[model samples]
Target: MNPVLKLTDVTRIHGEAPHEVLALRGISFEAHPGELVAVMGPSGSGKSTLLTIAGGLDRPTAGSVTVEGTDLAGLGQHGRARMRRTSIGYVFQGFNLIPALTAAENVALPRELDGVAPRRARAEARKALEEVGIADLADRFPDDMSGGQQQRVAIARAVVGERRLILADEPTGALDTETGEGILQLLRARCDAGAAGVLVTHEARHAAWADRVVFLRDGVVVDETGADRVDVLTGPGAR
Candidate 1:
């Protein structure tokens, strides 16, 4: 089967000639259905830039990014926004939930924005919350929940619509180890159900949950290995 997300020779440059910095350089990557690929690297290595470009939140200065078969550049601004709502789900390291909105409402917000009826959107949101194992907290506001609970709401929102591609950047960064592992388990389950996933993480243990691991350095893919062999990148004295 074809990849749900593909980035081909993608390059992203910030600023202009005199002050520009390359955030990504001739990088190509893909995440196929039923797969979870983890991108790992040190600070300034372009992991987050790669994710934003793939999710259409940022455009590449060169090359192409395709999601669910549509090239992002060809989509234009509005088109890309539409695609983001219908086909892609992004989870940020910081939970970007609205404090005033309850868990269910926050999860439903995307579908509602997409023109789904309020009642139907709510039903779907609750379903997603249930899938994330937090249905009981549907009415709790972000401020009223624990960090783990709030993050669960974030995950529910991301997968609420059966989005074809899921992009997560340091999704477990804010939680305790146990809570973070729980979050990773949820992501793994989502990929097992067929939504392609790309996780950007710096922790080797977290990356181990993925099917494959990609190592980046200075905006380039320096190496890649199956999750089972991640030690190739993080083994003792391997760096």
Candidate 2:
């Protein structure tokens, strides 16, 4: 089966001249259907940079990124925006929900933005919420819910429309340990159900939930290994 997301020798450089910052360099990665790849790295290690480029939120300075075989660099601004709304899902560290929108409404926002009818978008939103085991919280606004509930709503929003590629950057950053594990379980389930997932995390325990782990340092892939070996790799003095 084709990988849902692929990055080939992707490099992202910000600014220019002597001040140029290399955020990513020759990073080739892929997340296939039914796989969850964890990206573990220190701050400024380019994990987030890789994710942003994969999601079409930023362009690569060289090489290419493809989601389901469509080269993101070839898509014009509007086309990339449409692809993001229709085929890619992003879960950020912050919930990023609209304050006035209820959980279901927030989950439905992407579909609606993609021009799906309101009623149908709402229906799909409910289904997404149910899948995340938060159906009853549908009508609750973000401010009215606890952090875990709000994050659940965020997950629902990300996966709402059968989006094949899910990119999560420190999604559990704000939650407690138990809540974070719960969130990881949800992501694992989604990947099990065939969505390609890339999770950027700093914790070894969290990376253990993934099928494999990719370690990044100074904007380059330093090491990669199966999840079973993540403990050895992430331990103190291991790098």
Q: What's the lDDT for residue 42 in model 2? A: 95
Please, what are the lDDT tens digits per residue for candidate 2 over residues 3-27?
8988888888989979999988888
Instruction: Report model 2's TM-score to 2 decimal places.
Output: 0.94
lDDT score at residue 21, model 2, on the 0-100 scale: 95
For model 2, give the RMSD to the true fold: 4.2
| lDDT (Cα, tens digit) per residue for candidate 1, span 160-219 | 989979999999998999999999999999999999999999999999999999988888
lDDT of 1 at 48: 97
Q: For candidate 2, what is the lDDT?
A: 0.90
lDDT per model, in order?
A: 0.91, 0.90
Model 2 residue 81 CA deviation (Å) reads 0.5
What TM-score does candidate 1 get on C-alpha atoms? 0.94
